[model samples]
Target: MKTIGRIKTNILSMGCFAVLLSFSSGCGKDDAEDTVENCFGGNWAERYAAELEVYANAVSVYNETPTPANCASYKTAAKNYLDALRSIVDCVPTISRAEINASINEAKAEVDREGCD
Candidate 1:
């Protein structure tokens, strides 16, 4: 009888430990982006991807039907989008922030040089 009782207690303790472990493992994974270690987390990638799509669409539209005014507008929009990416400089890692800044500067120069040719 004593052996059976000890076995049951041990089983209950193991079950409780398993539940706690499961909960803890899931806790940080769900909020990974919000955690301090991740900083801007996944937002930088998402924002950059979205901005690229917008810039591509603008360029495509301008290319399909070129006009000086439309080209300038498209360039301006793309520049603005690229510039906004710099806002996450402090949030992202150092290497990424430098790369983003360089990209923005390079794109701005390209936009300035592009014309309705």
Candidate 2:
């Protein structure tokens, strides 16, 4: 269906966006230090990357089967990915919390539309 295709496209786009954002690195030492300090003394990028991987895997599984259980798992993975992004909003000055929140809400809406809730 067209709706399903659109949902897949949107989810893939979000995943790609997150990947690109997570790879954005600070060019200077000061920026790097500030990122780590602001990111709860940890590597938020690394954490986000890990969550992204989990989300990607879930997407793959859901696409292959689309069972209710897999849908729930996919939703959980999505939440985790969004949570990781939310946790690092302050660390990455380039991306705003509003942007991340919008992505989260959009993803949730898409999932709900698919009856994945």
Candidate 3:
């Protein structure tokens, strides 16, 4: 669950846009002018990965307390994840799902450290 926390912290600090741009700009996947848009999509995916990881953990966490706010955060995180997914899908060019999945898994340990449950 630390991975959830790590990513969440990164998003909260670095913001949703930062994650998207981090990869796009570094990946060298597009023209400089389109970098902004491409980064937007990429970072959104990153945030989605992090956000979902948290929400998924929250599902089990809420099994313990289940407060209204906690439940709502869970939903908001899940929805943000999904919305980010939709954005990736709607991107002009597709991204590598396998790579993204791998990256998310790499952060699993950190997400676990967040103490979700």
List residue ranges in candidate 3 displaced over 4 A. Answer: 1-28, 31-47, 92-117
lDDT to native, each model: 0.50, 0.66, 0.48
Angstrom error at residue 43, model 3: 7.8
Count of clashing pairs, candidate 2: 0
Using TM-score as the yardstick, the better of models 2 and 3 is 2
TM-scores across all candidates?
Answer: 0.54, 0.65, 0.40
| Model 2: residues with Cα > 4 Å off, grouped in runs | 1-12, 15-37, 40-42
**What is candidate 1's TM-score against the reference?**
0.54
Clashes of each: 0, 0, 14
TM-score of 3: 0.40
Ranking by TM-score: 2, 1, 3
Model 2, 36-116: lDDT tens per residue?
A: 455644445565778878988887898888888998887788777767766666655554557766876787677666765
Q: Residues 3-31, candidate 3, lDDT per residue (tens digit)?
A: 44446554343234334545454434454
* True lDDT of residue 72, candidate 3: 55
